[model samples]
Target: MKDQAKLASDPADWSIVETVDAVCAGHASALEVTQAVLDRIARRQPVLNCFIRIDGDRALETASGLDAARSAGRTQGPLHGAVLAHKDMYYRAGLVSTCGSEIRRDFVAQTTATVLDKLDNAGAVDVGTLNMSEFASGPTGHNLHHGNCHNPWNPDHITGGSSTGSGSAVGGRLVAGSLGSDTGGSVRLPAGICGAYGIKPTQGRVSRHGVMGLSFSLDNVGPIARTARDCARMLSVIAGPDPMDTTALPVPVDDYEADLDAGVTGLRIAVPKTYYFDDISPEISKLLDSALAVFTSLGAKIVHVDLPHHDIIGALGNAVGSSEQCTLHDFWHQTCPEKYAPLIRARMQAGFGVTAVEYLKALHLRSSIARAVSDAAFGDADVMFLPVLRFPVPTLSETDVGDGAGLHEILGSINHCTRPINYLGFPALTVPCGFSASGLPVAFQLAGPAFSERRLFRFAGAFEAANGLSDCVPDLP
Candidate 1:
């Protein structure tokens, strides 16, 4: 193996795939690629605190075995030498899987999550576990159990979570890619704030088995990467049916990497003049307007649509999510209440107050709203464009006080434009559009009908290509 000490001294030399591919093609082993990522993590972890755990020794062993097998003319998978990270909520067998809470700090599953197994089978090296919001609940990336993960773009600002570390680590270039869960825009919010690409795949499109549940109805496992193309590539591997998750749809996986350069000509796109554009900073509004202009310039027909009852969807989404989350953690709450974060505990407690009749009514309301949204916005359009979050990341102090009323107000504001689609179970992509005046990243989302990730990705990939925003990386201190 190449000298680990030398690789540890230089991380940028092995940060992107283009660099690793060139090195690997010239006989650099998978072990070398894995070591390079470990080396980078060593350099980055202290500053970013993006990872909860680092298993470099074990990763090196796996990489070396794969390299040895390949040396004997054995075939490996598509992501043969790629190194990736997963959110701490994902269960990797024998690894301590802390779902960013004291409740499950010592929990280790006997079996790995199907998504992790799929990535491993595809020959991707698991470099480490990224940080996340406790119980995958909050919008701001504050973790009372682990320290708050700072945004790479601006360490003083939030990273947007429950997928906090996934966004930060990838944006900070600590890892090439990472997996994140989205319930109420967890993945996309972080993607927007941290200047990364995030995909919240359609619910049940990817298996939720082996993941710590936040909201059974709304939780989605997806990818966060530096570019839309990278997100697509990772999705191709991690997405598919899993017998362990009966909710997983039996759909065929496509070659997401192919035809990525395809433009969005002739596609109908809509901009909803509703909750999406309300109350956001004027700079964010202007940035989104500029992004929409790019779509118009690329031959996409821009249409104006309205969803008058959009506000109800956000209310109903929170009710359903909170109720479901409470149900998932009833035992923990009853058995060890003190272990739970006060913020999460309060929200979970609110769930008990939500009656079954109300939960069922919320579901019915969700369906009605989804149908109305589809007919009004997506009836003639391939994708809908909107702001990912109404605002950019706030400071850590603002979010960490466990002030339930203030946190709810802020989270509700951030999820105002995002939770509606989660209620409807649609796929959404958040790509960086511009930066706020304070140098915080801002992003706009592309939402598509159920199982229309390909279409959404095509549109986002084109927008990314034209905008060339992926090249903007955070200059970490």
Candidate 2:
């Protein structure tokens, strides 16, 4: 093997695929890689505040075991030797899953998340848990409990919620990849703002067993990684039917990485004529236009689609999600209201006011709305392209709108670009298209019909390969 110190330094810059290849080839041992990752995390965590917990000892132990197995002539899985972390919400039996809140600050899980089990089987090393929004509420990464998760690009900028640390850690190169949950825009928002690739798979594509619930109807589990292929590798391993999570669809999981190399030859990408871009800033618009140009250059056709029901989608989605969240936190909200952050409490209270009629109506209309929107969007296209953020990345101070004053407006506007897709239960992938003038990242999300993750991966991979932006990392020290 190469010098241990040199190997460690280089693997911090390696993609998940590269890390796996090197470890499997015996070019580097898993122990060395885990140590390198821990060292990087130690240096970066204080500045970024991305991790809620760092299980260094556990990670090294896991890595050493993998190395021993490999030395014994045993084969490893796809993610063998790939060091990863996750949102603090995903449970591991007997481990404390804070869910980024003081409410469950010391709460120990009785069972492990299905996704974590699958990752272990795939040979991924878990270093620790990342920070996130309390109870996965809010879109601005304002965690009054665990401290806000800052953007790696600039510590002052917000790192989109509630999968804040997943995005920050992955983009900061502290880990190879991370698993994050998205109720509305949690996964895509963070990944986009941090200049990484994240995919919110179809509602039931990945099992949610042992994961904290925000809005069961809308919550999705996905991965954020440096490249589309890395995201694909994680998704392929974590996605599939789980007997533990009845909500997981029985449909067969597609080979998400299989068609990644296949360019978007004649694929049609739909651009909505209204709603999505209604309030976008000129700077963001230009970047998206350039991204479209890149897609066009790669042989994909861009079509203007008159998407249906854009006006009511966000409101309806919020109603369903809020009601569900309130239902889950009703007891604690009623008794221990003081434990929650003001903004999170206020956000949850909106759910209580949503009557059963409104809640049922929202749930009842989901199927019809999804069908109409999907038909309109996909009638002549393979996937619909939309902005992840309508404006440039905002500073933490600007978006730290506390509980009572201006919370709804700020949170609503921040999540405007991603909520609609969650409402429709479609899959969307966040691809970093370019950087903003302020040096923050801007991204576009490509959304496709339910269970179309493979198609989204292919398109995103092609764009990433062409633009070569996925290789860009934040200049954090």
Candidate 3:
């Protein structure tokens, strides 16, 4: 096989973009890529437990069809012949979609997700489903039903959750890219821990029609991949107005990869002064400084910005998320609460007393708060940068908050930089910067104004080129 290097589950193995080009140009066969991915999954899944299901036979069959189409001189779409998997939350018609809960263990979706449909039309192969937090509730990647997804960089470290499998699979190179939902940092945290790139686009930027709802207002559908270029390719195909989702923004989707090579020549970047760096460890702080120096070397100017209402913004997000989750699972909570995990059950219960007036008031403040964050960030900068996680990625044993000792404090700290941006309805991209002393990766998030993904990718691409960070795969020989 031409892509024999793909068998290692190493990040430097293959490219989603180039794979599509080669297959469509008759230079490579889709079946080969699928076989390589299946082989990697076999080797890596046992160690990381990243997948809930592996549809190897069906995936190989699909690849064979794509190969025939290419031989017939036909091209599918921009993503033609690329292989992928997604968080089990995304629906696929006629397939069992376990949303990481015992309550939905046998639930099968009747309609497919719009994002999945877009991907299929683009010629991307759906290999299987990845693991996630039980009901997408926790922050430290724990799932009582499905097994926890371990970090690929260090198997003992937690893979930041709800989108746990998405991060581990991409970082492990079992597939080129995967769709992950981000409601309060699910996508960002795993990216940081697993040493990969993840983007949570603006609220309503991607359709959530057939996606299981964790929070109708705060949920975002985005991509996790080895590089920003791969993410840009997937995001371009999945984003835009969708009739199935009324909340999808009507904004015109730009060619995300169009300006990725433009560089950050005159771009303004921000390093926050508060909340993000609060209580951060010395190692992470030093790493952030070094990451900024790389951007400075790329000709971007750094400005310091702060959000005094950041904590409030994050609290509001949590309040809304919990209340919405409780509202959706009311029947289950009332009758089958035992089916849920103890930690998430307690969190869901926290929203029971949220008065309608309180929830409404919180919703009303979102627009103003978004404007406040935007004003502070864009006043002197185009993008705001901060560490995705301030503390080191703890062992799975260190984060079992279900036992209730400091439960709130422990879970709250993991989503520090992530939840605030979701509440603001902005875009944030986490790119691996370096590894921590414990061997897990450290990352910095680049957040931009609403729907500015192109600008974010441009800056990220430039910094990635300067640092050569994503290409540093784990030595999985």
List TM-score per model, in order.
0.94, 0.98, 0.97
Per-residue C-alpha lDDT of model 3 across residues 321-365, encoded as one tens digit per residue: 878988999999899889998988887787778877878888999
lDDT of 1 by residue, 295-331 (tens): 8899889988886577577778878988999898989
TM-score of 2: 0.98
Task: Give the alpha-carbon lDDT of every model.
Answer: 0.82, 0.92, 0.87
The window of 10 residues in a row where model 3 has the poorest summed lDDT is: 3-12
Model 2, position 182, has a per-residue lDDT of 90
The candidate 1 region of ten consecutive residues with least summed lDDT is 11-20
Top TM-score prediction, candidate number: 2
Off by over 4 Å in 3: 1-12
- Please give, for residues 245-332, the per-residue lDDT of candidate 2 as tens digits: 9999999999999989999989999999999999899999999999999999999999998988888988899899989998999999
On lDDT, the candidate that comes out on top is: 2
Candidate 2 overall Cα lDDT vs. reference? 0.92
lDDT score for residue 358 of model 1 = 92
